[model samples]
Target: MNTDIAATLPGATKTHRDESFPVASRLIAPAHRAVVLAFYRYVRAADDIADAPGLAPEEKLRRLHAFEAALDAADPAVPLARALAEADRRHGCGAAQARLMLDAFRQDAVKPRYAGFAELIDYCTRSADPAGRFLLALHREDEAAQGPADALCTALQILNHLQDLVKDRERIGRVYVPEPWMALAGGEEAFFAPGNGPARRRVLDAVLDRVDTLLDTAEALPRSLRSRRLAAESVATIATGRLLARRLRREDPVTGRVDLAKADFARAFARAAPALAHLGFTSDAAVCRRIVAGSGSSFRLGMASLKGERRRAIHAVYAFCRLIDDVADAAAPAPERRAAIEDWRREIDRLAGAPLTPVGRELQAATRAFGLDPAEFHLLLDGMAADAAERVRIADAAGLDLYCRQVAGAVGALSIRIFGATQAHAFALSLGRTLQLVNILRDVDEDAAIERVYVPLDRLLEAGIPDGPATCMVQDPRFAAVCRALADEAEAGFAEADRLLAGLDRRALKPAILMMEGYRIVLGHMMRRGFERRGPRPRPNRRDRLRLVTLALRGQP
Candidate 1:
């Protein structure tokens, strides 16, 4: 530890958390603040070493590697290194991420010239990308978000680079200004030289154009998430990036310095309150209400009978469920798909009043309203994750049962709890299982097309149908038999759930009954139309829906 005290002092001294520069910001839960800060301390210390002009290149290299070594250590002797290790162990962070920042710092000590925009972006990959990646890990965001977060972080890095161009050239003899752009604008000498004011400004303007595009690319990132705290902070960061880009446009970057004023953030923060409300789970239950209405016809119809807190709670659950299904069904690459599902799991792990995604934040509010248990919420995630796989195999009835519990049964139980029914646990589970099984039967063709085989492998084999999505399977007579069998199971489940619901209060239970009946009617039509063949998918016709409303009027008739 005492190998070179004076040389490493700056990095060590700068190790304390910076109040002005939030590692994760106030929007992050206090419980997780330490994980965020631990990363910051390690990265900040390494960053200080790279920025240290007093330290020689070899010395910087020596100390930085020492920091890197601390990654795999159980307990690093260096304070910053210890924090890095602690964050890794505590939050399940990998040493690999800490190594990424160290690599960037190493580049900073030696490599100063960026030949092109792409090369500069590659630098940003290692330099700025790591921070967003680790932050997402802290927020428990999925891999789907990492791309956009990386884009945002890279833009910010470029902005900082542009803002410090003059100082870097004058003191360090470094040039991060892309080489090709420098030539296109004026020339290296004219752009970097202090006297050639007009030419240098032109080069800076060209650089600003590139930064502006990056900022534009990152615009939708905040909307894609549901966390209020992260939303508020991300919007603020986006606001600052936009503000800085404007400054680069207005001020002569070659002569004047660009600094973010507190007023700029104040103005943006005020604007963000409304933007965040739309993007975050607001107090008004708007996130739940809006997503439920827009998501699916079936959900809207089922939830129509619910009102007041009960309705809001169900909508919140519906909204949350809808997001998980969408993540599983998204046509992204496999890694991204898995990340999307894991993000849900992580958010649920640390769920509180404020979460990163707006839907999650709303669910938190809904949970508070109905006293919803997170354990059941977790079951919903497990179900979604199962669907996210390319080809989910159900070996037998047992597998299908677990899948149903994961996807719908858990949600059903949560809904019953929300609806003020304490004793109808079996009913809720049965209903969810019933609905999910019906959905599987109804979507057999559609699910097969998506390479999904929800019907157990044994059942498919028994039915003499192939196990994958193919034309032969579609035309096979056995496939129809499989559909019939599944439909029968769903029908049995429907009768059971209906019988169980009768034991609960019939007053507060109207909405629940209507929803169950809605499914029952759909199941009836599917069976009538011969579900095994290329029959039309069942939709509740106007008359059918009206009948449901009429039944509701008769007090669970």
Candidate 2:
């Protein structure tokens, strides 16, 4: 509706250019595309301004304030202002969610370090949870839906921050690891010391413990979403979050980058599907109570808000994902860790033969009910092993593709199974691949700084760029060429995602569309900037994001 705002913002072009909405293709129902696009554009735009480079500290503060003021005024001239207004007009989008985005940007500008886990949760409340809440509102879900949505969102935000700790600290000079834990490890100065040493390990262990606590909390939110469709989403998110958290806990924060393998994602999805489906039919209070009791502390606040069979199933799925992920990410040496993962994989395998533990029993029941395949579970373990092996440097587009398949695409395969998307598996896998590529592109700078390259080696060589993550982005002609090539590949992946969306169920379409569009927007930014030069990463401006949202609502697909 307001292209003027998109045109006016200095970063709007870059934001759109940098983002890669891999899932926002023709596969989506033309009806829902605009709304999905609009939401993503709004989020992207806000993020861009918050992360923009070359602005003085004062100027950054001023810009953030101006953005916040726009939210308050409902001015169409402001970037996200129109989207917020539209969400209100059409979907009853709350001012609180918009305000939360602004607050997160404010935090980005000011808060560089976290004091403790509580403070970290406060950040997630502002930054990550609001997006989930906004999406729930878009779906016209009631307070009951909103509560669980918030929990899942908050959990995801916490897990993401934990996973990116090393990269966040090294590239951004900001640390999300709690201050108290850092103190216990040997103080801030010691924690950041060059070289992987005992102090770093100690700090990481403390951080892992904190992560486990947060994950326990996150597992509690899915029970509130009574709708089978929404519960599936929540379960997938929880399973994914817990898996990542477990990796963060088990990995050597000094050397490895924590990421969910595609196979693992599929397994989580398969394991969570039946419970999610069951939620559609039952509203048993006892079931909800059992789930709440098992979820540990993360669900403590959320427990009182929900009651049903769906809640219990969600809790069981979350707990299982968290435990399995931890097993994969355990701090043991690679061989031992792989062995453990294999053992877990065997246990999952034997579920078809016989049940072992409560979690396993639950998973077996759910898998049977959902008609999930055992092979998907094995792929998850394989992906976890790949991650544990620290084998994810971006060497070329081919390598990147393989990595994406291992880390994210596999999840798509599993998700379709859980969603009963038998016919749409190919499309789902394509969308998943595109999303994974977008992630790699978005985190290029940060990933490089942490010595984990998801970029392909062949691409780098073709571009005549150095293979090392830190040096690849330097300003060289070949470096620029390589970046362009990679970006093009990402674009191609996005195209596939678009095709995939057209085949998915309508109820399951919007969220995937929004996520895809968000990533595509990021990839667009990367493409525009020649990807090689990275003083700061590019993202969408608020106005452009709003425009995208409007387009999504219009069903442009």
Candidate number of the best TM-score: 1
lDDT score at residue 215, model 1, on the 0-100 scale:
57
lDDT of 1 by residue, 1-557 (tens): 33343335473534333322234666566787777777777777788787787778788788787667655553335666767787777777735677897898998888878766667888899988888788777677777667667878888888878887877777666778776657644677766666776656655665564565455445556665666667666777777787888888787666777777778767666646755565432232664575577666565655776778777778878877876776677543334456667867887765674465545666777788888889998888888777777666688889999999988889877887777886888887888888988888777777766577787888888777656654456568777888788889888988887678666886666666777888888888888888555566788899998898787667445
What value of lDDT does candidate 1 attain over all alpha carbons?
A: 0.72
lDDT of each: 0.72, 0.58
Worst 10-residue lDDT window, candidate 1: 13-22
Report how far residue 443 has shifted in candidate 1, in Å.
0.8
Candidate 2 residue-wise lDDT at 74: 69
For lDDT, the strongest prediction is: 1
lDDT of 2 by residue, 1-557 (tens): 33344443445534432321122223233554466566666666666666555445565566666655665666777746666666566766646686777788777766788766567767878887787777566656567555445555665666656566666666555677667656645677776665646767755654454454344444444555544555555556556666676676677655666666778767666645675555432223233334446545322322222234333443444445455555544443445446556666777877777643445555676576656566766666676676555334554556666666765666556545544456777776677677776666666665554345666666666656665536444435566565566567778978876666665574444434555666677777777766556557566678757855664564322
RMSD from true fold, candidate 2? 22.8
